[model samples]
Target: MIKIVLLGAGNVATHLYKGFKKANTVNVVQWYNRNLKSIETYKNEVKITDNVNNLIEADVYIIAVNDDAIPELSSTLPFENRLVVHTSGSARLYDIDQKLYRGVFYPLQTFSKAVDLDFTTVPICIETLRKKDFKLLETLGQSLGCVTYKVNPKQRPALHLAAVFVNNFTNQIYRIAHEITEKQGAEFDILKPLITETARKVQEVSPYIAQTGPAKRNDKKTIKRHLKLLDNPDQEAIYKLMTESIKKTHGH
Candidate 1:
């Protein structure tokens, strides 16, 4: 079994820990973090430590912490000639340097402590400097989920930016829509089926083809009406910007 030591225990860490446990092929030998509460269950399963020096000897060590802390944590690690990996979408894998086998195991999806991750649907973006390390990453990723891509830092950033638009911006739009619907005495739950259908259609059709709403049709009157209803300048500005972008892309 592949001996793995995990670092950090946030949303990503918790999901990965559960995934690793379910994997059964690899064994999580040890873990460490600043807070004990973050990884109490992980501690129960394997050796856990607050001090970095006591880091268990493992074939692989994954740092699933904040993007800013990666450089600091990687620099502080005393382990030599061990495979070190980070699970971050925006962080470049090389931030950890070439002195050790450093790689990225970025899972492209929103993670919440309460939500169960559908690993099979989550795209795993992976990269490594060494050929052997890349193969090792592929092996582990396949067991967790089949969709895996080997991408460079430049390409990874584009994917990350696209995700921010699809996930964050879209969710924000949903919130605004919910507020407007509530004020109109319409239950936001009525929109859930439409939301699900829209997501489902995207799987089969290109977003350009599945496009709907007044923005796609260049209905300026409807756009103005919606913006006036929004009232909030920030939301109106966002709505206008997104509408313009969509028209620029899909409009003739």
Candidate 2:
């Protein structure tokens, strides 16, 4: 069994804890957070502690806290030469104290504590300083039924930047759409099917091939009308920027 000690209480950490609990070959031996109350409820299931010195022996120690906190937490860990990994997409693998085995176990997906997550669907990006430790991390990821990939430092950061464009930036556009619909007294739910179809289409074909709308067709009249409909300068700017991007992409 791969015994893991997860240290963090955020969305990624919470979801990982729940996923690990369900994996038969994986055991979450302990959970650590600076704020004990954040993980107090899981004390009965596994050892929970706020003190770093109280950490028990485990096969892997996962630091899932904020990117800024990673270096300090890694430095403060009571032991060294143990396998230590962080669940950050952008943070450097070397962020962990060099005294311990440094590695990254980034999950390429947005996480929310309230949403149900299926581990099998999430891709685990693994990187390690020591070649010997790679297999152990791969096995750890596989334990949760996740598809594992050996992503290098450059590729990992590039993937993370692309993720921000796809997930975070796309979600912001959705929020903008919601606001526009609300101002027009239209039910935002009416656009849900279109949103679902857009997502589904990308899975089957390249986004370039899936492109549609006035911008893609180079309908200058419709584009002008959209810009005129927007009262907020920020909204107008975003609409213009997106339209220009789409036009440029389609070679308009």
Candidate 3:
């Protein structure tokens, strides 16, 4: 079994730890973090340490810390005799120094502390320190049932940006719609079918082809009605911009 050390106790770490443990191919010999108390509960099951120097020898170190903390954390870890990886979609592997076996293992999905996640469906993007490390990563990815993609820093950043548009921005739109529904004294749950249908269409049709609404049809009447319905100027602006974008995409 490949020995591993996992850093951090946050969303990424928790999910990865669960999945890696389930795989049984990896032996999590040690887990390190800045705050000793953060992982106090798991101390008995897995050796947890606050001091970087006390880290147990492992074949690979998976750094799942916050984005800003990665470089500082990487600097402290003993990178020799081990492969080192971070799990951020936006951060490049080379952002950290090359003194050690450095790479990125970005999982392309938003993680929430409160929510349960299925790592099987999460797209795992792997970049590596060397050709030797590639096989190790691929093996780990398969254990989790992930759809793996080999991505470089530049391409990873682009995919991350697209994720923001599709996931983050889409969630924001949902929030706005929910608020509007509440204001109208209607259950926001009423829109669940429409939202599901939108997602379903995308799987079969290109997003450009699946798009519909006042914007896609160039229906001035519906556009004006929605704008009138929304009291918030920000919502109106978003609707207007999306409408224009859809029209431009569909060649309306």
Taking all chains together, each candidate's TM-score versus the true structure is 0.94, 0.98, 0.95
Query: Candidate 3's residue-wise lDDT over 73-167, tens digit each?
Result: 88877646468888888887876656778888889998887788898879999988688888888777877789888887689989989999999
lDDT of each: 0.86, 0.94, 0.85
Q: How far is each candidate from the true structure, as Cα RMSD in Å?
A: 1.5, 0.8, 1.3
lDDT tens per residue, model 1, 1-252: 777888888888888878887886788888788888777765557788888888868878899999999988988888778999999888888788566789998889999999998789888889888889988888887777648899998988899999998999889889988988988899999999999999999999999899998888888899888888887788788888889998888653
Which is the leading candidate under TM-score? Answer: 2
Best by lDDT: 2
Runs of candidate 2 with Cα error greater than 4 angstroms are none
Q: How far in Å is the alpha carbon of 143 misplaced in model 1?
A: 2.1
| Residue 47 in candidate 1, Cα distance off native in Å | 1.6
- For model 3, the superposed segments whose C-alpha errors exceed 4 Å read 79-81
How well does candidate 2 match the true structure in TM-score terms? 0.98
Expressed as tens digits, the lDDT of each residue in 1-252 for candidate 2 is 999999999999999999999989999999999999999989899899999999999999999999999999999998999999999999999999999999999999999999999999999999998887889999988988999999999999999999999999999999999999999899999999999999999999999999999999999999989888999999999998989999999999
Pairs that clash in candidate 1: none
Native-referenced Cα lDDT, model 3? 0.85
